[model samples]
Target: MTTAIVPDPEAIRPELAQPGSALPVPPQGLRASRNAGFTSLRVGVTALWLSVIVLLPLAAIAWQAAGGGWQAFWLAVTSHAAVQSFQVTLSISVVVTILDVVFGLATAWVLVRDNFIGKGLIDAVIDLPFALPTIVTSLVMLALYGKNSPVHIHLQHTPPGVGMALAFVTLPLVVRAVQPVLLEIDRDVEEAAASLGASGPKVFATIVLPSLGPSLFTGAGLAFSRCVAEFGSVVTIGGAVPGKTEVSSQWIRSLIENDDRTGAAAMSIVLLSISFAVLVLLRIVGGRAAKREEKAA
Candidate 1:
């Protein structure tokens, strides 16, 4: 009788023992993965691209702001136009955020929790700002509120007109952000709260509010950023009055138009810094809220 010798399975696949490929072959029934390292490479490339496009521009402005040292940066931030623009921009953004949250939450709740005739039309209308150009929105606002229009008769002197226009421009942002979150929320949870003797307000305050917290903050942060950086819409209706209505973006544009590149760069950096700080704070708060929701779930 003749006997045949067979090599060991492990020895036959010696490549498995190499430094990088130390793992054994995946299960016999499972197919081997192709280019498993490709994911990491793709992530690296994406990160590099973002740094080049976003971070580098930000760094350049910051570098210029610091060129004359901290004293110069301080002056840029505290200068008359800079200070006034900051105050006005921040105040308007806060007001807009509050109003948007209230209206957006209510709108989202109605859209997701109730059924009505023309629901589809209402939903589509919520996103009108997304399709409309910002400049066009400004023009419409100007047409309606620029002293000649009937609506402007009462609102001509007040900031209310500009505020209303900015709100309309940013409405879709808040609604879109909150709608998905509301849709994902469990209807049964609210019903359970009711079954447990919780009243409507109590159920909303204790359950629904917490669930909606992250989305609200996220949306408000985005809306605030958009509003603060807004140029076309605000300028078209705001009149860009330096101490009265000039926003940071318009102020920066004026500086650049006057050929004060250094000053414009400095003002832009200041605006960017403040906006970035606010956005980061919002994101941190949103993260905490998300964690609480996860825990409750």
Candidate 2:
């Protein structure tokens, strides 16, 4: 029938009046205000710097591309050389991406999971493409596969010319992208899969492949874009033969050589557009895959 008695309001002291916090209160007024202003200034300067260096170029390119009216843009995209170049670039990029995915995964897995006598040397060699000039890779491929080359004597004639060069440059991209992700993966998961009834292929397909999908996709997209814009390497090795080996970049070079600046710019716009489109599509797919994984987890 009786209620509990309530404590007095005046019993609470000033120290106990405020909400609990781990950090002590700072001296207020000018000092705190100046500190906040300095922090804001630093953030603003960093953002401004990045925008100038990175976003400005992108904005310039976009402005140039859109300078041509919609009709001109449409005409540029529909031209025979432009269409052919698009097809060729896309085809080669796809081919190289697939090759890089297979070989890149293998190389990343070996570098991350396996430790052999020449492991460090092998890892260093994988990054050779990053340091070596693209022209060098092109020359090497030409020397390896061209008609005058001794290595080509047995094969006689194989269209592996352009593909070989593109793959060489893209190999480092895929390997580097996947290597970090592979290194981050827990070895225990792989070991557990092995301990189960899973065989080598089974473990890789079910366990490793799923985890590597995002990095593999990012690497593939990067490789594809690189192949699409590739100039020095493919041009030296493949020779821009229209209806055959003429990639977008090579086609642009040829156009410029023929003193066709407008057409070259137009074609360059096409290449940039396709690259942006593909990149967007890939990012969307990667996002969906990430969400699905989150739900599954």
User: lDDT of all the models against the reference?
Assistant: 0.81, 0.80
> Worst lDDT window (10 residues) for model 2?
151-160
Q: TM-score of each candidate?
A: 0.82, 0.79
Tens digits of per-residue lDDT for model 2, 1-297: 999988765354444454653334555786789899999999999999999997887677556555766777677668898898888888878988899999998999899988899999999998888888888887877777776887643211233577888898888888998999898888788799899878989988888888888888889989988888987777667877786787888877777799765566677767777788879988898899889979999
Candidate 1 residue lDDT tens string, 47-121: 999999998998888777778787767777788888888887878878887898889888988999899999999
lDDT of 2 at 102: 94
How much is the lDDT of residue 257 in candidate 1? 94
Model 2 ranges with Cα > 4 A deviation: 1-36, 66-68, 153-159, 282-297
